[model samples]
Target chain A: EDQVTQSPEALRLQEGESSSLNCSYTVSGLRGLFWYRQDPGKGPEFLFTLYSAGEEKEKERLKATLTKKESFLHITAPKPEDSATYLCAVSRGGRSNDYKLSFGAGTTVTVRA
Target chain B: GAGVSQSPRYKVAKRGQDVALRCDPISGHVSLFWYQQALGQGPEFLTYFQNEAQLDKSGLPSDRFFAERPEGSVSTLKIQRTQQEDSAVYLCASSFATGGNTIYFGEGSWLTVV
Candidate 1:
């Protein structure tokens, strides 16, 4: 069975503090890993997509890196407004018509001023 | 060229009632998806559509859940005989193609089964 697990269910960080979230997966074949940020009462907003090990992508203050079995989302100098639930998902195999994704339980981050 | 959009940002339905949620994908998008999210959990895949074809409905929890995309641009998710366990946020997303790695999502429709 394909499964995704995210560590640290919830985290509280002070403004300007930096932290990292982890996402690990077990699948028959690796295809793509995705990161999303979701705000309260809204759908997830896409952050990045890593297709291969050793690949990384960054946007704003967030950086996502991928390996053979896991992915990491690093937040640099996070602010209160940056607080949101971060989700990680993985597609079972290489890109195909059946691009089904299994997602982790997400890590909630709260940045206080 | 707006992003995906879902109707009735919030809906409250009584148990045993049937409800329909709608999703309008971005213009020209070929792939559309539906997901169900319980509070505090990540969204779970429910179904997938490519153009007017329903490709995958394996993730749907039960037979009560049915989704259709007749015209290929707008889609609807119908839940029959809603139960309290059916309560969740329904999310809709669309991408340029069925195999695209990046997908854009709508604000989602929150459903409450009373």
Candidate 2:
């Protein structure tokens, strides 16, 4: 069974404080891993997609790195506006469609000024 | 439209009532999808559509949950005999015709079964 587990269900960080969220996975084979940020009462916004191990992607103050067994999302000097629930998802490499993402429970990060 | 749009941003239904949630995919997006997200949980896949063709409905929890995309651009998810367990946010998403394209999602339709 393919599963995704995110640690530290909720995190509180001070403004300008840096932190890292973890996303661990177990799957038969991996096609892609995706990261999304979702705000309250809204759908998730795409952040990054890593297709292979040892790959990384960055956007603004956020950087995502992937490995064979886990992934990490590093936030650098986050602001209040950056607070949101971060989701991790994976697509199976076999016959599973690329869009059929299996998501984790998500990690909620709150940044206080 | 500029992005995927959903109707009835919030809906409240009584037990045993049927509710229909609508989704309008982005213009020219060939693939559309429906997901159910419970509070505090990530969205779960409910169904997938490709140009009016219902290719996948395996993730649907029960037979009472039905989805259709008759025109390929607009999709609807109808829940029959609503139950409290059926209450969740219904999210609609769309993607391009091919490859690993980014699946864009709508604001979602919040359903509360009382």
Candidate 3:
């Protein structure tokens, strides 16, 4: 079975503070790793997708990096608007389970001005 | 139209009643998905559709939970004899191609079974 685990269930940061969130997983064959941002009442918004170890993607203040065992979402000089729950999901390469994503219990971030 | 769209942003149902939720994927998106999210938790996969074909439904909690994408563009998820545990936000997502693509989600339908 594929399992995803995220660290630091919650985070609090001041404006301009930089930090990172972690997502570690164990899978038979890792097809992809995804990062999403979700607000209180809305669904998750896609952030980035990392396919292989050493892959990275960036957008605005967020950067996502992947390793064989884990992935990281780094927030640089975050503002209050950057506050949201960060979710990590994985898709495994298998005949029957490749279509669905396995998600981790997300990390809720709060940035205060 | 612009993104994945879901109907009935909020719903409250009594136990033993039935409810249905609808999802319209983005234009030209070939893959659609349904997920259930409990309070303060990440979304859990419920089912998947590829061009109207229900390819995977292994994550559905029970037989009472059913989903269909009849026309390959819009999908409906129905719950029969809803229980209190069924209370959660049901999210619909779509991707242009398949599993490896970025999936965009709609504002979920919040279902509260009491």
Fraction of the reference Cα-Cα interface contacts (below 8 Å) that each candidate reproduces? 0.74, 0.70, 0.80
Off by over 4 Å in 2: none
CA lDDT of each prediction against the hidden true structure: 0.91, 0.92, 0.94
lDDT of 2 by residue, B1-114 (tens): 999999999999999999999999999999999999999999999999999999899999999999999988889999999999999999999988534578888999999999
What order do candidates take by lDDT, descending? 3, 2, 1
Candidates, DockQ = 0.71, 0.71, 0.79
Docking class of 2: medium
True contacts kept of 3: 0.80
Alpha carbon lDDT at A39, candidate 1 = 94
| CAPRI grade, predicted model 3 | medium
lDDT of candidate 2 at residue B76, scale 0 to 100: 94
Kindly provide the TM-score obtained by chain B of candidate 1 when compared with the true chain B: 0.97
The DockQ-derived docking category for candidate 1 is medium
Across B2-89, the per-residue lDDT of candidate 1 in tens digits comes to 8899998999999999999999999999999999999988889999999999988988999999999999989999999999999999
Which residue pairs in candidate 2 have backbone atoms (N, alpha carbon, C) closer than 3 angstroms, thus clashing?
none
Better of 1 and 2 by lDDT: 2
Residue-wise C-alpha lDDT for candidate 2, range A1-113, written one tens digit per residue: 78999988999999999999999999777888999999999999889989899999999999999999999999999999999999998887765466688899999999999
